[model samples]
Target: MKDTQIKKLIEAEKKRQKKAINLIASENYVSRDVLEALGSELTNKYAEGYAGKRYYGGNDIIDKIEELCIDRALKLFRLDPNEWHVNVQPLSGSPANLAVFTALVPRGGVKQEDGTTSVAGKIMGMSLDQGGHLTHGQKVSATGKFWQQIPYGLDPVTETINYDQLREIAMKEKPTIVVSGYTAYPRIIDWKKMREVSDASEGLMMVDMSHIAGLVAGGVYPSPFDYADVVTTTTHKTLRGPRAALIFVKKDARELYKKIDKAVFPGLQGGPHANQIAAVAVALKEASTPAFRKYANQVVKNAKVLAEELEKRGWRLISGGTDSHLILVDTWNDGKKREPLVKDAAGKAEAGAGAITGKEASERLEKQGIIVNKNAIPFDKRPPADPSGIRLGTAAETTRGRKEKDFKLIAKKMDEILRK
Candidate 1:
């Protein structure tokens, strides 16, 4: 508190967040208890390993804190202790994903002249610009560097994932793992179907449900727990927790679990953030309550109402509608004369609506206190620098107690800015 400059900036940020209409899909507001835990004295500790198995001393209490966090994570998520092993120590989702890959993939299968191990496998995930996260084996990510990326995209017209096509691709690629869930696509994922594909291809099923983890907890979204071999989720998104991630492994794979723990500790990270772990514990406890369930349900309700209102004003949403907490809207050239239909880089047809580029639309919205991010629509002709879609989510606003009517009003405000 003595640092006036930092304190002032933090205060300003709090005020700014209070006034901004937050719609970024990957963001949420944590409760005061969670915030307090984040700033607690636990920050000074360096717990290099799991509970009661640390290389560093003075970590007995840190062990208890982490154990509590992992326990709550498993309990809150309804994972049976007999069937699951949870890892709460990956810094965030990206590293959590990397840990999973390192744990599951056969590393050091080949050694080059440099005396370093070479890892090789196919990681099948959704395409990044088409709704996948970068860590899902995108060429630009390290995961892609280590493994061949076999990416999938939504059907150019319906905008839903073509599962038959996905299975065919999986059969051909014989991927080491198949990832479900996404960063931008709004429709619910068919986890069971993904599991089917994974089984058919003899691949591991990992659902990166970071965006919908809270929705899964609240019983709104389809839970991947029963199907995925590994489930990775960030605690912050719809979970309304700290910026931490949880990696869940099915109990049947005891061998894989051992590999995962090693990857998280000595292989990928060291001295896990005890304070963040404690905050994650608090947030997990909060997420387990009946009140949080109501909040999660309301988040979906608000998103639906907002999406409907936006559509009423000419915003064409991907997949026609959303069954989750987010919405992806196409916002490319509003006035361009077009043929009956448009095509993509693959010559596949796409159906959608008009002018302001996603970035320009976002800039205009920000000036009006509405926060959103530019995103690439499936087969978007425009480049990433200026994509054809804007992504929105209701998690933070719904957490602030906004409801269907509030979101409808927010949609009207967005209409005023984007309708031009």
Candidate 2:
């Protein structure tokens, strides 16, 4: 296409992005500097390996950039820069988790030479409904199909992970890997407590900090690096980087690190997207700045303010509150009411609303220039397609320089629609 056509497309996309009230938990706005790096000349090169060792020649500049990224990641995580190792090449979060699992699990299909599976006695992670990711061994996931999965869950009333119950499950199941982190959860994970559980269970604790990575980086949330054996995160969500993922392995897990690298390069993906890596580097650098810290703080503040405002307006919230950038709004009364009000309001709105239920609410919001996703609350009986709750986060809006005032406005709009 000609430059004019390209310019038009860019402008149109920018306009679309700017107009929307992006409340999706997994979304965020990246800096223009990061965008520039993503679209740089690095896209043309193919660097198959780490900084120093590449399969092809002419990687001198790329090597330095990659090394700088590694160093910055280590620094952000408060690890010894020389001792820490990170693989900044994963395509995204799911693949990164898969790579971590592949690395930790014994090769040759988890079965030993004696015709017995090595992981038979080992447990992995909690279930999806229990606030764990698919890689943490949901039955539909490849991980569950291959290895033993011992599911854990949150307390029915508290709506938070029952650490005591989790310990009991860990002790009884004796999992080889205890995965920490979550996708839809809105509170802070106790990595220290999780580390203790992993030690007691003789398992490795891998923390998927994909959601709160920016908060962790900005020092607003606790870093899991101090306790986790392995850490994985997406660069986009809270990090405000490219749509990519990263795997950080502790120094002692050198063998595991090699396995992770091999799994990423050979088992999962081929040549790395050098452009994304460059963007990640720029983002990491940005994350280390004071401005990013302010942004992280604002994300949490906005979430709290939004949650409080919604609650005061009679909207039921999961956990009754939130500590991170996300909040789960319960539309149905303990999964009893169908909530026709949501549909009525969406229908009456301009451009129509997104969806009626949390699912429909999300759809309706998108139609009205606001964006969010429906989510299943704890102890939910419904399928994910039409859950009783909508998940909203402040990362993107905060990145856009929004504050508690903006959150209050968004909350009012959401209340007007859902509580009509």
lDDT of 1: 0.88
Residue 122 in candidate 1, Cα distance off native in Å: 0.6
Each candidate's TM vs. the true structure? Answer: 0.93, 0.90
Say which candidate scores most in TM-score. Answer: 1
Please give the lDDT score for candidate 2: 0.82
lDDT of 2 by residue, 1-420 (tens): 479988999999889988988899999888888989998899999888777888889999889888888788888777885566798889989889878877776533566679885544354576676567887777787777666677887888988877878888788778878988888788889998998888878888889999999999888889888788889999999999999999998777345778888889877897788888889999999998998899899999999999998776667788899999989877765545433322334464222222246777777777788889888878877678988778899999998888888889999898777644
lDDT of every predicted structure (CA atoms)? 0.88, 0.82
Name model 1 segments beyond 4 Å from true.
Answer: 112-119, 333-354
**For every model in order, what is the number of clashing pairs?**
3, 8
Q: In candidate 2, how many clashes are counted? A: 8
